[model samples]
Target: MTLDPQTLLAILAMAVATAATRIGGLVLFGFLTLDRRQKRAMEAIPPAVLMAVVAPTALATGPAETIAAAITALAALRLPLLAATALGVAAVAALRAMGL
Candidate 1:
């Protein structure tokens, strides 16, 4: 099936809007002078957002994968963040490879 011009334009518009929303926040936040409280609040945002995303994913995957992911998160907490991410991804990939 082929998308007509209008359908393609609509899809492109949606993509642009999503991109604008994401990048616009960075631009706006960068220019604005945030107070100390606001800065602290922003600092907490990432981990909260990460957990918001991972929580449902962890729940859906069940106890074992959740445990593995938790261990990965904890390890990442202890070591370099990138290494932890790589280790966690490798663990998940290996589990899938072995048909876990």
Candidate 2:
């Protein structure tokens, strides 16, 4: 039911390591020259990561949740990310309130 200090520390360490690895690559890349192939791959990285993040979150709950999240994201693109997130959360809350 609860995470002990040791387990929590390990989890934190892993998170930091993963972040460092990703950032370290970018830092190192700046000092070096990326070839054409690498550059092309890098261009695709953003969309790939977007999909990687979005696909799972969309499917995590259900179609309604996914639709709500999509609407929130779309709103965030036009408005502030916080406001969009609030809208998405509000949509979910309203659905729950309505007993949907």
Candidate lDDT (C-alpha), each: 0.73, 0.73
RMSD to truth, every model: 3.5, 5.2
- Give one digit per residue, the lDDT tens place, for model 2 in 1-100: 9879999999999999999999999899889888999887776555455545766877697766777767765775566556766787898677667665
lDDT of 1 by residue, 11-97 (tens): 999999999999999899888998999897776565456556776887688555676577666765566555766777777777766
Q: What is the lDDT of residue 53 in candidate 1?
A: 72
After superposing candidate 1 on the true structure, give the runs of residues whose Cα lies further than 4 Å from its correct spot.
4-7, 35-40, 75-84, 94-100
Q: Candidate 1 — which pairs collide?
A: none
lDDT of 2 at 69: 68
* Candidate 2 residue spans exceeding 4 A from truth: 1-9, 18-54
